[model samples]
Target: MDHRTQLEERIAHLTRHVDELSEVVARQQSELDRLSRRVAMLMAREAERELDTGGSIPLADQKPPHW
Candidate 1:
């Protein structure tokens, strides 16, 4: 094939690869956002639970038995 044709093919391949990577990144970002919201909700629930229990120190903040 001619040099110009080879360059065009390479460009097409690279463009497709970039597009695929962009899709993956977009999916990962969506997943991250979902996980972040879930974490925040869990934290809020835990805080509410702590308040209900009269403001006890959260278990997560306590030192382990081995400590």
Candidate 2:
């Protein structure tokens, strides 16, 4: 094949690969957004529970158990 035709074929292949990678990135972003919303909801619920029970942040975020 001529130089021009070979170059065009390579360009088309690279373009298709880029398009596929773009689709994968978009899907991951969508999943991350959904997880963020879920975490926000859980935090809100925990805060409301703390108000009713008068507790502090969970032991996970607290000082060492030995202290």
Candidate 3:
């Protein structure tokens, strides 16, 4: 009930919240790294496919008909 006790409780709660958020950020970072690698792999595969098809320009670089 004292001021000092209330401050200590608030500090404890804030510390716990910060720790939880840090863990969540770490998990998100790990997921982002995995997704980035997967994207790179997919891009490489697509580039190979384009080359095999003997395309002069990549499909991604081609303009759509609506353009």
Stretches off by above 4 angstroms in model 2 are 56-67
lDDT of 3 at 13: 100
Task: Please give the TM-score that candidate 3 achieves against the real structure.
Answer: 0.84
Which pairs clash in model 3?
none
Q: Write the per-residue lDDT of candidate 2 for residues 1-67, one digit (tens) a residue.
A: 9999999999999999999999999999999999999988887787777767877774334579788
Candidates 1 and 2 compared by lDDT, better number:
1
Q: Could you tell me every candidate's TM-score relative to the true structure?
A: 0.81, 0.75, 0.84
List clash counts for every candidate, in order: 0, 0, 0
lDDT of prediction 2 = 0.86
Task: Mark the regions of model 3 whose C-alpha exceeds 4 Å error after superposition.
Answer: 57-67
- Candidate 3 structure quality by residue, lDDT tens digits, 1-67: 9999999999999999999999999999999999999988887788778988997776756789899
Q: What's the distance in Å from true for residue 46, model 1?
A: 0.4
lDDT of each: 0.90, 0.86, 0.90
